[model samples]
Target: MNGIFGYAATAPSPSREEAARVRDVMAARGPDGHGLWSSSDGRCVLAHRRLAILDLSDRALQPMRCRDGRYTIVFNGEIYNYPELRRAAVAAGHVFETTSDTEILLYLFARHGAEMLSHLRGMFAFAIWDDHARSLFLARDPFGIKPLFLADRHGTLRFASQVRALRAGQGIRDERDPAGVIGFMLLGSVPEPFTWYQDISALPAGHCMSVDASGVRQWRYTDLTAILSAAGGRRGDRHAALADARAAIRDSVKAHLLSDVPVGLFLSSGIDSAAVLGIAMEQAKHPIHAITLGFDDFAGTTNDEVPVARRIAEYYGAPHNVRRIDRAEFLEDLRAILTTMDQPSIDGINTWFVAKAARENGLKVALSGIGGDEMLGGYPSFVDVPRWVRRYGRLARLPGLGAGLARLMRTVVPWYIAAHPKAPGLLRHTSTIGGSYLVRRSLRLPDDLADVQDPAVVKAGLARLEIVARMNATLNPMPDTPQAAVSLLELSFYMRNQLLRDADWAGMQHSVEIRTPMIDIDLFTRLAPLIGGLPAGIGKQLLADAPNKVLPDWHRHRPKTGFSIPYAGWMAGIRDLDQRNGKAASSNGLLSRTWSNYVFQQYPAGA
Candidate 1:
């Protein structure tokens, strides 16, 4: 990904150089080319590092200035429908000096301003400076697949793809904001508008912040929940919803495949990735390279959908290969990963392994199945959470028994599946608001944390709970069901922290670009309206019922297993170490011990 860093004031050259250093630090993202530009009046400076993807011509090197010299932009994303947008722009008699989408984006903004965001469909987070208007325009995508950091320290405003990029600047981050760090540990990553250091903020998804000397104002341009509520249940019924969903998926995959570079597939035994492969194969002229990942020596059942992946690949006569991560290498890579993690997360390692394979296979870009579940009610949480929610009414009226029953649940369930059957994994995953599933789902609930751990840690959690509660209150004004809220929670939390970060860094570690066809902006707008009123007994039922133009039944049944990790089976690793001494390490809950020991602690038949 590329970055934008600058100072709009007539400041010291060294100050601008410091901003340039922040942009330069992301060089691993851009090895082929780089450039920096300063406005003739010296009031603005823009710097960019590049990875040559499309039209790898020198003309595409950016910090691109508009023909009228009224604007400059530094963007980090692909305009998947660039060719189509180009046709429209050209028809309007707009001239172009380069074939890159970066140019089209600048020109589109010149023509449409913020309105340009709705017409373009791809993952993006960008910053634009209109010198004539003396304003800075910044935005992130509806799905937030790409990241942008915004920090306002004193009077200067700084932005970049990663916070580290912003941190590289000398004068930025004047305050050591521990509140963000507290939020990070409590929430697994800091929430939007809060960063590890206090002064930095993330520009939240679907929102834009426009700043100039007059001051700054932030506004949200999209709200999927409201859109879904307004769309209602009629269009989302099983038959009609499926049709719109199918059309959206195919169109998005087609647009995502519009790169000048050799694109490949990160095929897994899941419907999402399989759907991507299936759709791309129809339009692709040559055999596409497909990749599958596995653990060769581990004793646990390998979540190898390699068999399923091969079934689909062989059926299509597509060329494919398998890559393995033996136990030893997984350990070795895990250590390097921790230091390189940029953000501490349980994901990204899976992406690291596969993206490395794709890079070696000579593909510069790959497609993923992200956003498929959120759009289609594919998660069990969408179903199971509501079940527990029904039971929650009974718990509330019971008064004193509520705490007792929740605690009783903690003791009976096995560590492996303690919350299983009672609560869906989704509700248990994040600390999102008002889901009854939280009773069955939490790793360790607030009371449990208060009872067993450090009081200081518990107090810290309570403080962040206050923050999340306020956020929940803010979102309450928008309308939708528990399902829609759960979907949004996943998007805000897991998708950003786990999936997208894993995909981007792992791919970039090899300079490979991983694209998600299912997450196109227009496609999301179309599908968001169809998600609310789903029928029971069917998962991703909407997508399943659609008349798929290209995918076979083999791919059609590919469950969303996602990059499966062997979470069970006794292994001699830090997992065991973490179990024994990892209590202090857990920001969430304490891991449970073996059954015999727990039973020993209780032991009387009627005790």
Candidate 2:
């Protein structure tokens, strides 16, 4: 993993000192080396912080220039298919400098421009300067395994790999975005295209943007719905589809394993991680390393993941380490974890600890089974949302049915069930898949934000941030089946906003790279047609069956339990924080809503 930062200006040119300052903010992402480059006219600057995963040589240092000096690129993330891409480039009469993927990427873009993104098969966020056209091209990998943030200030477009880095060096006053504040409260993480800051924006996943004298333009290079749509009801035999899905998974894991350093697996009790370990062992040339995180609260209970994870690791002959985390250790690292947070999120607590453990073991990269649920029919959302729609379709469409019931439920329901803020508002989302998803995943209903924040702010934020509309926008080019629709929603919203982004910041907090092989666009494209109408009850069945029966019956057939922490109990111990009172208020009842707000206050925009 690395960090990229740069600015392209039309009138107000950037300076070398400013670029250096931006690069310095993310020095931890690339402790091995750093570089700064500027155009001859000083209108553009590119900076790179290199983690040195691919080629550990000075020749691989960037901001790398093309052989003819027509283009310069500052890149972040790994290009797993660089060897094949390099060979293709060479066959097309391209010359090479270093064996680094960064150079291959620059060369590929030099020849193919933005179209080169289609050929890429790894996680990346990069900016390429076309000196001849005085234009800059920026692209983020389809799944957003990497992050990119941009800001417009004084006629210059500044961008960075992280929001904090962009804020630290953009040289502008940051204002809190009311919509982003509400988005976080409603969804537990800020939605795409909006950051907590008013001026700065996160580049959406699966899209590219360009800045030139003509102005800025953005377009999607790929999207999950579009890819799934291409399936065109082409599902074949069930057995054959299962075989193809397994093959795709195997290929993806092998591809992600391409690295100069040791790659480890974040093994868990779930079938997703177990499947990944089993597949990696079959394809890998050497022994795989595995790490599992367990909590003291669930040491001997079914909730403990260490025992099962340890069994799978031993089955695969991987060197395993069960990182037992206790309440005292969590408290000790709570301050640092809060500080490492790039944005306020209630999730990522477990990720933060696991990444810390991985780094302590001297590993730089680890594979995670994050998108397995999204790709396969692994989440309860797959069934619950559709069922809600079926059961309450007509009533949900009544103008005031949801709002009226929400009020009644809040007044009468007990704290345990009522603490789930969205339960009463279920009817509001049942009319459409997008609306249903918002209610399904929401921490608090959008209409309830007024209870926590100012009425004016909540009103204005709700107007600006249309949660239902945003969800529907991802569904415009719809998938063929209800199951595919749920998968698309999960991948676009939950996996992108929470899981992938969390993995980036938390893993980088310890300088450990977290790779998700199941989330690759290529792999998704292959499995989409086969899994389109997959039954929600058969959670990850294709994956569980794909590993040549490596998974034991319990690992594959056990009840689905998520990797979780006792956040409510732990946060209660922190004296500085307001303890959760058993009330159905929007602000203090739920641990997620309270923690999200606390993190925001802990690290305010530009803090």
Candidate 3:
């Protein structure tokens, strides 16, 4: 992974020093080399910190311009299919000055312009300045595997791979975005296009924006849900679908392993990680390393992943490393973990530790199983949300009944029921896929936001978030089947906002690149047609039925106890969480809320 930062202005041009300062702040993301380029007229500047994953010479250094010097780019991602793209570009009369993907990308853009995004496959967040057109084009990858944050304020447009780096730019302020703060409180992470800062915004995943003398125009270059819907209703033969899925997954894993540096797998007892591990090992030319994280509190319990992960690693003949965390170690790393977080998230601690372990073991890149659940229906939302919507959706029509039940649930219900969070709001979202998802995924129910956040902020945030309306806007115009609906909701909300963002920050903090083969856009486009119409649980079967049978039954059949830390116990000691509140920090729910608040306090968005 690399870091990219740049600025474009229609008025007073920003100085090179400002872009360099942003680069300095993000140096950890790309320690290999650094460079800066600016237009002669001083209207634009681009800076890059290179990690040297591909084409490891100085010629590959970025902020690169085309052979004709008509186009300049500062890019921060790998183009997994660049070899093929390069071959096509060469055949199409495009000349490349270097073997770098950056050069290939620049050439491709020169030939195809914005149309180039559809021809590429990989994670990317890049800004290309068209010297001739006098326009700046910025795009993020399909699934948001990479990040692109922008601050468009004070007559300047500044962008970076990390939000903090964008904040480092001149003329950007740290004023709190009420919607973003409320989003953090509701979802434990801020949603796209709404960073914690009022002036800063993330470019939504799978979308691109162009800035020129006229104004800013943005559009979705690709839509996963639309792809899924177009491919829905194809309910192919089960055996054929399974075979296709297995083949697609294997091919995606092979593509993801295309880095110059050694890559490893984050092996867990779960089916997702195990499946990825198996595929990666089969494709790797050398012994692949597998890492597992365990907690001392779960040593003798079924919750421990180390033992099962070790067995799977041994079966594959891969070197296995188990990093066990005792309370003492967790306590020691608490400060660093919190500090390294780019945003306030209750999750990502597991990723932080696993990535740290991978770095310690001399691995520069590692693969994770993040998208498996969203892609293959592993989450309960696939089943539960649909069931709830089906059961309670009709009752929602009886005007006051739904609201009355929600009021009762909020005032008198036990915390366990309340902790389900979305239960009360179930009636509201029951009518549509977007609404059902909000109920299923919300950390704090709509009625309960006042308990954690200011009433004014909550009102403003909810209005701005327009949670259901915004979600509905991302949906396919065609109605989605139950399975496809949940998949779309999860991918758009939880997976994009939490999982992918967490993976990026946590992995990069330790200088380890984390790849998710299951998260590939091309793979999803291929498999969506085959499984989009299937019922909730069949997607898992499709993924598990690999032709080689590399996964053992024991590991695959094990109950899905999510990869978790003993955060409740850890927080009790670290924050005195148990005694600070009137209630015990007995459940992950309360502990999560406490920790979320603490993380926010430590890294306040407004600050």
State the lDDT of candidate 1 residue by residue for 1-607, as single tens digits: 2333234353333355765788776776677787777665555567777778888999888788888888888888788889989998899898889888898889888888988887777778877889887777888887677777776655567677776667777555445344443444333444555665566777877888788766678888877556655665446355665677778877887788877777888888777776667667776766678988866533244366778778877765678888877667666675555544544444466788888898889888888777777666676767665565564555543555654555555666546333342332223322344433343323334444444435775676457545446445534544366766666656655566557866766676577878887666677667765655555424354443332445575556554565764432222344424444233223223222221222212222121
Please provide TM-scores, in order, for all candidate models, with all chains considered together.
0.84, 0.95, 0.94
Which candidate number would show the highest lDDT if scored against the true structure? 2
Weakest 10 consecutive residues, lDDT, candidate 2?
Answer: 1-10
Can you list the residue pairs that collide in candidate 1? 177-198
Over 4 Å off, model 1: 1-14, 41-43, 171-189, 233-238, 298-302, 397-433, 437-443, 448-461, 465-481, 537-560, 567-607
Return whichever of 1 and 2 wins on TM-score.
2
Q: What is the lDDT of residue 224 in candidate 1?
A: 58
Summarize candidate 3's per-residue lDDT along 192-289 as a digit string, tens digits. 88988888888988999988777678999998877888787665676677677789999998889887778899998888888888778888887779
Model 1 lDDT-worst window of ten: 598-607
Candidate 2 lDDT over 350-405, as tens digits, reads 99989988988988889999999888888888888888888876678889886677
